[model samples]
Target chain A: MGTEIRVQQDDFSVADEYQQLAQESSCGAVVTFAGLVRELAEGQLDAMTLEHYPGMTEQVLADLVAQARGRWQLGQVTLIHRVGRLALNDQIVFVGVAAPHRKAAFEAAMFIMDFLKTQAPFWKQEHTTDGSYWVAAKDTDQAAATAWQDD
Target chain B: MVKVKFFAALRERLQCAELDIDSQPSDSVAEIRHRLLQQHPSWRRELLDNDVLCAKNFTFVDLQAAVNPGDELAFFPPVTGG
Candidate 1:
């Protein structure tokens, strides 16, 4: 019955987030996803810097969470995204969902993530040994977001 | 005047993060972009790119979307996030 959305420069703990979602006694399932920064195969990597539009980012995330709730019987949901420079292997984002059934938790988590990819106002810049460049949006992400429209 | 903002690589390319532009009630997002280019002729290339995205008052809008004074407009490339 609660939703937590955070856009921060600080790292978040997956375990703590899971514990928070598990607090809902009525929920039997909890699903969580954590995204990380990975090294590039082409060259040595430095770090990934994340940028976001302050006011718009939180609002968009809340809206996505609301949409997920509307579509599913969710109990508690938590979404946290980190901004600023992140080293390789650093946790970048986290999504956790609790529901009475596994299906709703899984689907709601995926739906929030899918929509967030294309709709959220965050951007990533990859810093490599050679130079830093903005990561391009993938067509696959657009397709993933669009696929949900048919559901 | 409307506040305009640029984010990520677009900000670096344009070397401008934010700007204030004079606008009329009838102005559309496209027209505001046109006015920006009129002020900074060098920004034409980046601003005119078809891939560039614009949002008015924190909501995504098409070029034809109407705008007004006191509104906040953001222009940037497609978002890449999880």
Candidate 2:
């Protein structure tokens, strides 16, 4: 019934988030996604630091959820993203959507993630055995976000 | 003055997190960028790169977008978050 958005330094629990989304009894389908920090090369990554524009980051993420709601009939949405240093395999983000059916829930969850990847004001810097470097924005990410524009 | 901010790698490259510049209500993002480059000269490469992204008042905008005094302008590389 409400949209929950959080940008924090602490990690989130998927089970807790899923339970919150499932609270809406009217919505039978609940779709959720969690992203993890992965090693670029086996045993190469030491940690990853996430930086974000504080005020702007929250604004953009809310805008993205609004955009998804406009396109889909969602009952409740929860979007959480973590900032600061994260070790490998750490949970980085979570997106959960609830809807009357699986189609809207699934699509809304995907749409939010796609748009957030490119539009959110968050950046990642990888600290590896070699050195620390900012991760480049991938073309594949841009393409995925663009594909939703066709709709 | 317009509040200009840089983030992530752009801030590291420019060695500046934020700064204020004299601006007129009629000035566009392009004009402000040009003035910035003229003043710093060294920021030309990072600011002018095709991959650089700009936002006015927390919303993405292009170079042609107009800016008023007291507005917030941010410049950064493309975002990589999911």
Candidate 3:
């Protein structure tokens, strides 16, 4: 199993992290994804605040990385989520996975974000020109998490 | 009993965090929500919105689920997280 964990306020470089994760020769493919803040959220957003549970948020993220490792084999897994007041164009999250082949690397990265969207205790607060809104968890996210039960 | 928390606009309306809900035999997500409004008038405000959101044990929830003793439940507006 391969995994790396860190919580930082600054953005992370996926290309650099991927290099470290897929370093071993046996590793054939490295898949990495970055989530960036967008101008519009749910169709309305002048500004947004991302809230996370202090201790709980990190624990949940680390656990998710471990779970992904249990499902795949190769080199490393990396997840970086930024907290505090963030504006548009800021990097929000990073997920990188290493595997012996391409498929595991690709799928595991996607799966982790899908699960994290609902499972993790992170909240989003949006501020539009007219008003501000908080991003609550959605049922669709829970259903996505449920599908992972079979996998 | 379980402790439920609120955040963002929902929290603003409820005006607090960590709601202590006593256990009931048939206590459910919807049931608890109904009773919670009885406790605080403001809790009912968000529901008027078409797409308010909720979660059970930190994950989003649907109508089919119920809350039991020691289960963490949550309520908030629709998620805008990317």
TM-score of every model versus the real structure: 0.98, 0.98, 0.70
> Which candidate comes out best when scored by lDDT?
2
- Give the true-structure RMSD of model 2: 0.8
Judge the docking of candidate 2 as incorrect, acceptable, medium or high: high
Model 3 docking grade: acceptable
Q: Kindly list the per-residue Cα lDDT of model 3 for residues B1-82, writing each as its tens digit.
A: 8677776666777678777877686777777777777777765667545566667775567755878888887666544443
Please give, for residues B1-82, the per-residue lDDT of candidate 2 as tens digits: 9999999999999999999999987999999999999999999999999999999999999999999999999999999997
By summed lDDT, the worst window of 10 consecutive residues in model 3 chain A runs over A40-49
* Candidate 1 Cα deviation (angstroms), residue B69: 0.7
What's model 2's overall lDDT? 0.95
Candidate 3 CA-lDDT value = 0.73
As for TM-score, the candidate ahead, 1 or 3, is 1
lDDT ranking from best to worst? 2, 1, 3
The list of candidate 3 runs beyond 4 A from truth reads A4-10, A39-47, A53-74, A114-121, A127-151, B47-50, B59-69
